[model samples]
Target: MAKITYIENGGTEHHVDVPTGLSVMDGARRFTIPGIDGDCGGACACATCHVYVEGGWAERLPPMEEIEHDMLDFAFDVKENSRLSCQIKIDDGLDGLIVRTPPRQY
Candidate 1:
């Protein structure tokens, strides 16, 4: 399992142990992390699961696909580090990943 840290906009952090091979959004949703709604159910159709990979983690993640990139544009508070959690598949390399959620989901 990998350890994922979800930091809310107000600075609250939720740590979860996620099984490898699952999507980051699934882990957040399973743990009930407040900021990631995952409205599209990991289909890459919605931006509600938007989050930002803190610091160097962004470089470690795989490049976003065109669909994910387009959906991210609809997310609130998009930034250089922004990503759709649904698009990130968890693995051994992603252990201890930290992602920060935006203040708003819309």
Candidate 2:
């Protein structure tokens, strides 16, 4: 399992042990982390699972696909490191991954 830290808008942080082969959204759900709605589950259909991956960590994740990029248009506060948590797969290599939740979703 990987230890992923999710920081909420108010700086509240949640650290969860996310299992490999699951999406980052799933990890948030497991811990009931606020701000990660995951409205479309892990299908990447909704932008509700949006998150901002911390700098340095974004480079380690896979390049965003066209669908993910398009979906991000519906997310609030989109940044250079913005990503759909549903599109992020947890793995041992991401043991200390850190992500930030937006203030709100569109």
**Over the stretch 1-105, how does candidate 2's per-residue lDDT look in tens digits?**
899999999999888899999999999998899999998888988899999999489999999999999999999989999999999998899999999999997
Query: Which tens-of-lDDT digit does each residue in 8-94 have in candidate 1?
Result: 989999989999989989999898889999887888888999999995899999999989888887899899999999999999999
Best by lDDT: 2
Query: Local distance difference test, per candidate?
Result: 0.92, 0.93
Clash pairs, candidate 1, are none
RMSD of each: 0.7, 0.8
**TM per prediction:** 0.97, 0.97
Off by over 4 Å in 2: none
User: On a 0 to 100 scale, what is the lDDT of residue 48 in model 2?
Assistant: 96
Error of 1 at 73 (Å): 1.6
